[model samples]
Target: MTTHERSKAPAVDGAVLIIDLLASSAFPLTLSEICEKTGLPAASGHRIINALLEHQMVALNTSRKKSYCIGAKIFQVASTIYSKQSIIPFFYPIAEILKNEIHRPIFLSVPIGNTVVVVSKLESSLNATFNLHIGQTMPLHSSASGKAILSMFNAKEQLNYLAGQKKTSSHFSELLPKIKADLERAKRLGYAVSQGDIGQYVSCIAAPILNLRNEPIAAISTAVSNEFLTHQEARDFSKKLIQAARQLSSRIV
Candidate 1:
């Protein structure tokens, strides 16, 4: 007789909730199916679906029982998120290669405002790597993947970002110089590192995956136990990571 446990986070808008449902679904859903799952009323859901269809954000499966799924517009937009053109289709190959070369957990992160969202992750089968999941967000200044992208920003952009970070936490303001220095060094080195920045027992090394405009849209990183990370490992992995980033940047649209 008990209802399902509820989340503490505030509820999202109905339109956004519908979009999220469609994104999470593996297959197209009928109007009723979407409404039932999202708890949206049939009338409101229909109106939202029609609007989405008009904008090419959702497409109806006319051949089927009027089921709906993501549209070409969403696909076009997704093609350029964290990973260029398409996150998985473009990044998975490189992720596999990095996994083979580095023997550690590889993660792909996209910047969503001040935080980075984990889009795709390849968990290491060796020695139990970091237990992170897809859709998890990490702070821009507190994680290696985040730093890799942050370092790609121009001087003005970097300063503005540091100012924002400093605003969020006065404690980090004292370390702003060192943080900026680290990003500057990473730009020159073509890779970034997080040594006990996110946690004491874990560490990461990352490189930014850029676009045709030379702006970073996402980052790729390998995670491992702090004890396992060494100077030699970082150097070797960094070289490979830079190469991978360059290759991906060139190949993406």
Candidate 2:
């Protein structure tokens, strides 16, 4: 890539370089070695490494003091991409069922790093429906589906994710506590709610699909226009959403 293009995409370029280097290597690399190989400055490599580590795309070998290697997330993604019928087939029908019941745009999503990616969606037919497409991603703190998945993360994972965010998030400390409270409430209610955080004039209700061990592997959500969402009605929809999520979780695990 040209210098100007690379400058415009520093984060993407640095991340791609680090992943390519680690994937091609037989052994883990030290922080200095990665910087040398990528020709990235020490500080630049450090920032890239922290971001990758938060996603579990790379893991630190603490025993070796700063050595890094591909983490389990790589394998998880590989299996999903390479394998046929990787959970989507089983989940979409459930999303359809929920949409028919709620008459809203239902979505299936999986948490990847600090965000959630839409894997499947059943679009609504209403004239004023909200829109969501498969493969779209949203930040964990901003979307209902994202927070539903985040509510299931352990304390350590949550801390690691928040700590790795880009430097532009100067007020993240002030924001994290509110997100934490939302997750805690979601955990108790078995669903999460978000108002226009991910979409303008849109409200969403989401619930986590749990694995056998009760960990959230993914989530299901319904996004609707704010005009249709009344206070009591939102809670009722949340309960129904949780019920649908639990049903899907059982079939998947």
Candidate 3:
């Protein structure tokens, strides 16, 4: 075979071997483990692992000693791509306006795997009581921001997702019916609400942000102290939250 043919052959095999190893449960593998799993021998596996590490496609877990895992570079690329396609920047002005109008903390959240992670937050200038830092993850069955995103999925999908959570609360089983009912109500009202679910004395209202294909990709929410809003006031804030979410969705698509 030609030199080009010989070079291409191992490259294809190495790529496939790397992918297979990554897909296995034996991840965060040491060099020995990777060699054994891929049948690539020590020297070959070392070269492959080094190449992946150099590209930041794989990472070393120094704390775990000799373990390797997926790297933050993947997420960095994903965040960059999503930001380019998202309406988040476009909706900042409107989110600020909503914060002023509702006099509450406003937040924008997007689904990352099984969790809803906060991407942006606007603090309430009026009270300054409740605050949510960006990058915080909320429970799907509890938080209004999470429910708004969960509402986009069907019942079976939602149940399957909840089942996969290792650390589910006992409250989840007791409140499943109520959670379903709330999701139904949210669908009709175009938003969702939560009271003291994630944090004591705090309440939130949220609505979904739909993508170009009309699928829910993210959510926007306003959070406040329970003392700040009465039942009726909370309901009204949910409406404003829906409006803001709709506005943001429109801009993205």
Candidate 4:
């Protein structure tokens, strides 16, 4: 078999080189410092930095106005990487066990902006009307998995997320009170339940998978028929889900 040479782009290479320099620096680097270290032309470096800033790959330091550092987007990407690599591997067996016990579809999700994206899913054999797949994004206030993750956030963080929701959701103002109530109940119960909030004739129960700092890094949820959404059964499912979430979280490190 013949091996193929890799393609390269000078502009992309320079951007990566600039990111590396910023990442290795003890402090934010000024534009001149970045150009000097990367050996790129000043104009080209400035354009690259501006592009990075636009995409939130890099950010201006608040204290040092002209200096730049890594941005929140990079850390968000890194967290997703960490979750997929370190955490998801430990989730399958636990999810499989939960799926078997509850006879419902199980999903594993991680936060992205104000939403949660499904990273893994194990479907149930039962003919349930509800369905979810990998890469599907769910609203934080409407879905069990999203609520589970949100419930773990502090009041300030929760408020920030909800505030951002106003920009995209038309009924956000009206839904605010109910969403807050749901979050409080989720926090109190150590799990969240969405009764027909995600779809008709289906309900979901989820629990947050926390990191070492007790912050939610991911959530595990099971989607079941509305028939099982009754008080006693919902509590039962929540108890099992919370246990599985804790078990998976314990093995994350």
What are the per-residue Cα lDDT tens digits for candidate 3 across 197-217? 657888888999998787778
> What is the descending lDDT order?
4, 2, 1, 3
Please tell me which model should have the higher TM-score, number 3 or number 4. 4
User: Which stretches of candidate 3 lie above 4 Å from their native place?
Assistant: 1-85, 166-171
Which candidate number has the best lDDT?
A: 4
Superposition error at 10 for model 1 (Å): 7.7
> How large is the C-alpha RMSD of every model relative to the true structure?
6.9, 11.3, 10.5, 13.7
Worst 10 residues of 1 by lDDT: 1-10
How many backbone overlaps does candidate 3 show? 0
Q: What shift in Å separates residue 148 of candidate 4 from its native position after superposition?
A: 0.8
Per-residue lDDT tens digits for candidate 2, residues 172-239, read: 77887888899899888888999986578888889998888888888888876788789898898888
The positional error of residue 45 in candidate 4, measured at the CA in angstroms, is 30
Provide the TM-score for each candidate, comma-separated: 0.67, 0.67, 0.65, 0.66
Candidate 3 residue pairs that clash: none
Candidate 4 similarity to native, TM-score? 0.66
lDDT of 3 at 3: 33
Task: Give the winner by lDDT: 2 or 4.
Answer: 4
